[model samples]
Target chain A: MITITLFEMKKIIKSIFFFVMLAFLCVFLIGYYVFVHHQTVPVEKLIVETESMIHMQEQQIQELKRTINNSEDGGNSQLQLDLTVSEQLLSKNQILLKAYQEEDWQAVLQQEIESNEPEVERMKAGNEYYTSTFPTLFTLESRLEYNKWLLSHNITPVLPIDFYSWYTVYDLDFGDPIAEEYIKKQSEKYSSTGVYFLHHTLNLLFTIFGALIFLFLFGDILTKEGLGKNGPIHFLHTQPLSRLKIFIGKLLAVLFLSLFVIVFISGFCLLIGSLFDGFGYFYYPVLIYGEDFSFTFQKMSTVIFQSGVLFIFVLLFSYALLFLFSILTKRTLTAVGLTIVVLYIGIQWGKDTILSSFSPYIPFHYFSITDIVTNTFAASVKNFAFSMSTGCIVLSISTIALLFLSYFLFHLQNKLLH
Target chain B: MIIHIQNVKKRYKKEWVLKGINIKVEQPNIIALVGPNGSGKTTLLNCMTNLLSFHEGTVELVGKKHTDPSLFKEVSFLQDNRILYGNLTGYDHLKFICNVQHLSTARITDVAERVGMSSYLKKRVRNYSLGMKQHLLLAMAIINQPKLLLLDEPLNGLDPTSAITMRNILLELYNEGTTILLSSHNLDEIDRLTNTVYFMKDGAILKESLLDLNMRRYTVSVTDGKKAKKILEEKQIDFTSINENQISFDETTIDLQTFIDYMNQNDIQIYDIDKQKIGAERRYQELFEGAK
Candidate 1:
């Protein structure tokens, strides 16, 4: 079995097609990295957005002043309080804009906390809640904590520590559109080689092309043995090994080969990231959302590790699907095609259906690795059960079930029964 | 018994490809399976090696069922080049086989040297010629020094020199106490290799031993061949066969020495005596004569 498996791996590694696909992946990654870098919004763009936001606030302040002047109550009316908060917010943005313009890292962190702390405290005190379109108290508080941590460590910020603009809530609605745009810009660079940026890079790659890449790599694992017929499979079959051993050898080959490709991609990403940008903070704060707008914070390292585990499971599950298809179809392209189509349809259909009550039991619902680790997928599907632990279990069970199904089918066609 | 295949039946869809093939090899010798196209020669070999599913009966090799993988420890099948991985070097293939058969790595170099493919052993099979592939396949088959060797068309793409090398290897293996059952269309080479023949036609086999049948056929061409025939007949030397102006027979009818003496005494000037072994081709034509 060891010999067979090693030979199988050698076959895949030696294939010209495999090498070509790998080269293509490298080119694609480089192209994507360059494209993303160009897409990162510059500081000047954020400054303009901030200035326009200040103007909008000024207009709102003028309207509030008029309402305060026309109020029947004395200056102690609700309009007076609204006027005060708006004026304060306007003055704070002016200070933040100046700090940002000067590139004064300390003042920027100080201004962010000074500006957002009052509103957050107000929400905590059961006063008028912070604007519904802004970050939740939990997110703002997490941001404050990340800022405090950075300030204490004397680390200059490469990307904003804003939890509202964190990986999970990257597109969260903000009261000021300019603020939303600014946060999106900060989060767009969340793809560094830093331990903090690992999940983003992984999510970016795996969520989009992980399955397809893996499928293309090993989609013909079984069929390339000439569909287990008169092809080179007979070479192994005529050996001293049993059919079960042959199947196992190929199965293990898929597993090991998948690992090899995954490691290669990761190493490539690491090399690219390390070369361009210094490794970022190891314990960078990553905000994880919970059901009902509740949330918590996990270290970026933990999130990345969890994503790594879940993504591995997802890849193995994909191999199992391809394995079964390769056996059933007995053709490389057909097997790859059917596996992709099946996975696509299964995930699409599973989202609104199984993602609810059956999310923990169904693996397809957990295809979004970053979302699963961050609970954003669960929050989106309204199923809090789509966590990393559940994904591991679900994917393992599904993969094992697929293995059994394929093995049973193989047994039926084996010469033993005949 | 080295190889025991009993009543093995295999069918493809609605047609039976192998109809109750029963072959037992008790002694170490090279056996040739000769048949026309689609006669189930390869299929029968597959059944005996358990490479294909046989619907009925059993196959045993080296005291174990053919289905047992360990049986290959003492058994090897030299199949078509389709079984060769194009991307792997010939050395890689040989080493892999040795590993599986629990043989040492030393066998690869040894076998490569013996098979005379040592020079190109490191080259990928994809770049190998047809004869080179046959060399590699033959090397892989014998790397384990298998007790029973099954070869299907081992000489399909070999030049004369390569074919001779293969025949010599097969003969050497047979002499070394390895039982060989091979199927091929090369009748002259088969005649040179072994006398045991299993003629397969329409999924059944007619096993024949050339030693039992008259292997040698001598054609005597002489001046006045008609008189020679008459004189030989009158001399009570029974003729195995008599053609126009030529007398051809085997030793079964009478001794060659006595017949030559009588012909010489009759003053018949013998011009030529063309000797030939009744190999597979002649027997194959006779077996499948007047039938497509």
Candidate 2:
């Protein structure tokens, strides 16, 4: 039996159709990441130029203060003019603040042209000067300070000269405490670069495709026992083994293959991310504000283990569903299609009001409780114990329910003398 | 004894598929469960192996009751289509069956060889010709040297040569004390393979004919055509006519010399006398069609 299961696994791996789709998705993911990365470059440069302008304004302020001591109104008009120019620059670049944070730069550049602010034109005029001169003044070390000073002086520079109206008061400086927030947010930039969008779209497409493959391949996995060229019940029930063992063996085999596909997809995503986004882990958080917010291997392994337990429950439930449907229907497709439809409806119901109460009872709900697994509740009496106990209880009940349902269906199939 | 089924009744939707079937097959006997389509042959076979449930009945194979743990170990049911795994090759099917039967791993190769499928063992069962599929099934059935072999339509796709070879193999197995119960549409094949003939129709065994003529003792020697008539008249015996020189008797109890002496006493000159073995095909048709 074990050898048979291993052989089944090998067959799933050798499925050329599966590998072809995976390969296409892998390539598409990589290509999309590359495109997104390229788009991030221009935005990063714009941000860097804005930082340099703030520092330049600061140096000019210091020189003016020195001249003021020498003569009361010395270069004051010139200073005011420069201040006005800086204010104009800040207003011009205000759109970049919202764009940068939201990762919606394309929307801003596309939509900002109708604005009627003086700074939009000033920022447009200052674009070449800021781009060329800011580079000579600011180094890597002085860049942060320059951005801080300009932000304090209300100077925000929007990037890529676009024709958008700019009437609103532009507060370039996020705030004193917000500087840390901005830096933290800035490090994690969102880009709608062609590559990123392409990869995102491809991920959805491939995932849907992969799931469809699994649904079709395994949906009838058990029901095929009934619907093969031979009668399903005849072939399977005739074996010496009990129907329960056969069902379990087959269910485990499919789950094993599904897990393989899931891992394959995850690996493919990582490879794509590596090529395009400089290798960021999806589930693991990299350094954010010098703190490791990542759920590391040690932590993730627990999630994996818990997830494995949850998966067993799901597998059992899926088997039960298929088994019951198989018992009720003639063709394997009917069983499989009904299962997919039920799951779809179940998911939709869980999202809505009527069936949401039964969500805990739904096997699909337990599939993604990793969030619950990772969350460490506060030391309150109800929080920690409730979460932990509920998880374990629900897991136990779901497992038992699945097993019971499967056994009932097995008995039914056996009773069918046909 | 290999199998015993008593008063088994199975129904499919209001129709009784197997109506009170009672059969017992003891060792060293090849028994044919002859029946037509929808006749309870398969149902009874399944009941014996516990593949399907019967509402009322008792079935035992190798001393284990139906649904008993040991039932599967003792019986090998070769269904026409359901007996094989499609994805597996002929070799794989044999090996898997061997493993399931707890037979030696080498029995897979051995059985495949015996079935003359050694060359096609590696070919997938789905890709096999119908004849090849029959061979693979037979290989699996005999892989374990199972105490009781239950084959449903085992000869369905087999060619004449393969069928003869299979019959010979089965007889050899029977000689070694293996009990075989087979179902088939071919009455001729069944007649040759088994002594106990079960004629069935509409889910009931219509009649059973015991083939008692196992020896070659009944020889008809005709001296003169008139003398042959006199011997038949004097002895109160029945003989079937052939040509002018030969005649055959259906009974195996009569001696060849009795006919010769009876003819000689009648002053008839003896020439050539030959006895031919009776084929069971005619007897089988008589048993099935005559009763129906």
Candidate 3:
């Protein structure tokens, strides 16, 4: 089995297609970094710009108040309302800016929560001030509430709203709501400028072309031997190895190959990011959906570790599924096509279905493992209760089921041979 | 018994490609399977190697089931050239086989030299000609000196000299106690390699021995064909006239000496005599022609 796996690894690495796709991935990573840099605003620059905007808004509010007071028609009701909202927003921004300047995120979060509570209570009791502001206060109150929860749990409160405007801001036309939400949530959990860039870089890598790259790299793992008029599959079939061993050998080879590519590409991106920006704080906070479906922050290292585990499981499940398809179809393109189509339909459908009650049992729910690890899937999918432990179990079961079915199907593949 | 195939039945869709093929090889020798297209020669070989699933019965190699992985340690199937890996070097292929068979690297060099592929073994199989691929297939089949070797069209694309070399190698392996079951359309080469022939038609095996079918026709070109005909008629011998100057007769029916003596006595000068040997081709025609 080891020998077979070694041979398969050699074949994958020596394949011209693997190297070609790898080259394309490297070029894409560099291009993606450049594009991201162009799109996103630097955190320090954004803070300075926001301070200036706050000062301008304050002056405008004061000027509007004076003009409305001088008006003869009951001080122009709409202008008064605008001044009131602007003054409230200006006070909130000044407090946030002071907290940011002092780096006292806890104090900023406590103050925001304290300031929003009265409005939230008054809105619940039908107050005109909270009602007129409606959705804006509703969004602010939710952020403040979540931040207070983070602070109470001894977690640092990172304001997602502060950086939400810059997350994939220029790449908005991607039109994937889940990806957009993921980018927005990830951007909200800013630690340092460097970590912020790294976070988005990795997120873009996973959300955009990750699945397609996996398909290209591993789609043919099983079917390549059976391709063309003259195939080398017979040689492998005639060897002194069981069908299960052969399947496992190929699976391990693809897994290792994907790992190698992921590591190489990620390292390249990180190096490029560091050269241009810098490596951000290793202890940056990553906000994840907690057990109660509320937002909370975890250490970036822990989130990364969890993402890595989920990423591996996703690869295993996907490749094993593809392996099964390859055995059934004996065509690489067909297998790849079927896998991508099924996954696409599943993800699209899973988002709308009320499967949260049984989401842990549904294997497809775990396919988007990055979303699962980041708890973004919980937010999108109704009734979803995503936990890392449940996700691991679900993926493990699916992966094993896929592999066993693949072996069973592969054992009968001799029927297809002439 | 080196190989025991009993009542093996294989069906493709509604058609039975191999119906009740029961072949038992009790001794180590080269056995040739001859048939026309779609005659189940390849099917039977594939079944024996478990490359194709048979619907019924079983194939036992060296007293173990054919599907058993351990059976392959002593058994090797040299399939068509289409089975070789195109992207890999011939040496890579040989090395893989060698590693699977638990043979050392030295065995690869020895096999390469023996098969006359040492010069091109390092080249990728895609760049190789049909003949080179055949040589590699042969080398792979015999690299481990397997006890039971199944070859499907082992000489498919070989030149005359290469075919002769392959035939000699098979003969050498046969002498060394290797049991070889090879399928080929080259009757003459089969005739040289082995006398045991299994003629397949419509999924049935017709076992035959070339020694039993050793019939020949001797053609004699004479100066006086009329006189030779008269002499043959007087001796009550049967002969067919090729032309006015040449007469041919079955060697089994008439002795060469008796005809030569009679012609000499009749003062007929025999310019040339040729013996056309009856081989697998003739037997194949005799067996399958009626069915066709």
Candidate 4:
């Protein structure tokens, strides 16, 4: 086993470095574009711009009041006012300001004072009437408070939040010192504004590219032993050892080195993210949905357990495929190439055949590693009486079958290829 | 018996690669399985080592069934191609095989030194030449001091020195009670080393000759070889000739003595009377020619 592992380690050394560097560069660029520069620049400028606009509106309202008091037409003319359209517009803005200060957008108390034109009067009356009548369920303040609640509770998002649009247009500033600090801390958690599900899907697609890179480089390690024109078949077979041992040793080495490549990429991604954005991630207040949808330790534990189980299953499935390929081809490069082609095709086929429909019933649907990020397919989809039980049964049976196939191919190589 | 093959027959489509071949070998002897290119030698060896499944036969080794995993501990088959991991140094290769073979580090060192590969043990096999690779393979072949060693054309690409070294190593192992079944095309090497030879032709053993003693023979060059042949025939003596001068006959019978006496009487002065040793090459040719 040590001999096999050592060989496998040496084979994957280059791929490990290659993947790690790739992951680092990818994450670094994403962090620099979205978090470090994009997030801070426009947000700060928008805050200042919103404050200036509010002050300018207030000054325009004061100037209109002076005109109304000084002009003879304004003093006695209740029906025909001397106020310009801009002044009336500015007066309407003051009403909006008073409504905002009251932490609501209801009807103004003095609608007749702002305008006597039946059209303007009716518009102001309707606006104020709806505010006083309709119940305010989803306010901006309540939304921010919900976000704070989510972070403290570690609630994952089940729905999208377009905060960038609302924040830009409404100028919903959290000027309260404590609230401001809370908002900044929460904003730092995510560092980007987009739909969670879409964001995750895109992340998975990018990560697929990483997997493809690994796939391309995978076969270089395996075929080097078998594909040489005049290779040392005699040396290996004549060593008074079982062929199975040799096959197993080689398998172990390849798997070990392959894992190292995966870890190197993961570590590099972390390192680049840290370098580019000072090691931070954004948090959002979110509503989670599942079997146990709650902001509790038990829910978090469920996520970890479910995700871990899915991860292991996916890893085993991939390893089994690679093992079968390695034994069948007896050449590392061909095995890797075939594995990639088959897997790439398999994923597409599976998506079309199984995933687009009731794919959760198919055991292979859950055998996807990308599901860890996307969170679409799970062990079971329907909440039937024995759905979970059926899913486990199917998964276990398929996994065992795959393992058997791997061992069978390995045994066949020993018997026939010798 | 260290290795035994009983009526083994292997077929590929309509052709019988090995036809009911029977081989029984004991310890402390170098047995060479010599044959032509497709003469069932490799197939028979593969069957004995359980690498190939014989259609009609049973193979036994050291009282254990060849199909049994326990027998693997006793038999070490040196395959034709030296298959080693590309990245593993020769030293690492030895260590890996030694661990599996249950031999000590000292034993590995000893085998390395015997094969004259101690200097190149630390280098990767990718860097080793064909000769060096052969040495490494030879080292592995004798690693476990196996009771039965199956070598298929072990000296195909070896240099003279390495060949001699390998021959001596096989002899040494034989002395240590290791029975070796070595296959080769070069009949002379087998003739020098092996006690028993299995001469195969057309998928069957044509002859199994136990070479115990060197038969005495003489090659005579006659001035009138055709006349000499007629005289020898009248005298009822056996002789084989080439051209008009050269004649060959075994000197085992007293008929040759009588022929020499008659020759003396007739004053037939023999130009040459060189002693002939029946070599493996001649025996190999005779096996085929006699079959025809």
Q: Which structure among the candidates has the greatest DockQ?
A: 1
Write one digit per residue (lDDT tens) for candidate 3, span B59-167. Answer: 9997889889878888889987877767778888888776766779899899999999999999988899999999999998888888999999988889998999999
**Clashing pairs counted in every model:** 1, 17, 2, 21
Task: Give the winner by lDDT: 3 or 4.
Answer: 3
lDDT of 3 by residue, A1-418 (tens): 7778878887777778878988887787677777767665444554686699898998999899789878888587788889889998898788777766776667666775676677667764663222222133334444555556656665544344442322311132325667567656555443323555556655655542565678878788878787322467788877787777777888888888777876776577667777786765556555565443345656666776677677777778778778877877878899998888877876676666646566566666675656777676665453446766787788799889888888877877666543
Top-down TM-score ranking: 1, 3, 4, 2
lDDT of each: 0.78, 0.58, 0.75, 0.57
Off by over 4 Å in 3: A47-198, A205-209, A227-230, A293-296, A379-384, A416-418, B207-277, B289-292
DockQ of each: 0.60, 0.32, 0.41, 0.27
User: How good is chain A of candidate 2, measured by TM-score?
Assistant: 0.51
Give the per-residue lDDT of model 1 (tens digit) for A233-309: 88988888877888889889988887787677777766776677656565665668776656676766788778877
Clash pairs of candidate 3?
A160-A188, A195-A280
Per-residue alpha-carbon lDDT of candidate 4 for residues A1-418, written as tens digits (9 for 90 to 100) = 5654554465455344446656664665465445433433333343354456657755765666676767776655542343454566565655545544452312322332223234334544554322211111122333434444444554433222224221211223455667555544444323322323223323443233434554555545444555322344334443444656565665566456545554443444445445553433234332221232111122332433343444444444555566677667766666766766766776676667653444545554444433332232331232222233344555567656766787666555434543
Q: Candidate 1 DockQ category? A: medium
| Candidate 1 residue runs with Cα over 4 Å from true position | A41-107, A127-133, A146-198, A291-294, A354-356, A414-418, B207-276, B290-292
Kindly provide the TM-score of model 4 when superposed on the true structure, using C-alpha atoms. 0.68
Arranged by lDDT, best first: 1, 3, 2, 4
Docking class of 3: acceptable
B1-292 per-residue lDDT for model 2 (tens digits)? 5677888888878888788888776655788877557777876776777767788878888878778745666667788765565666777666655566567888777787788999989876677888998898788777777678888998988899999989988998888777888888887887678657676677877643444424442444455776686567677786655667556665453577776677777887767655544445555555655621
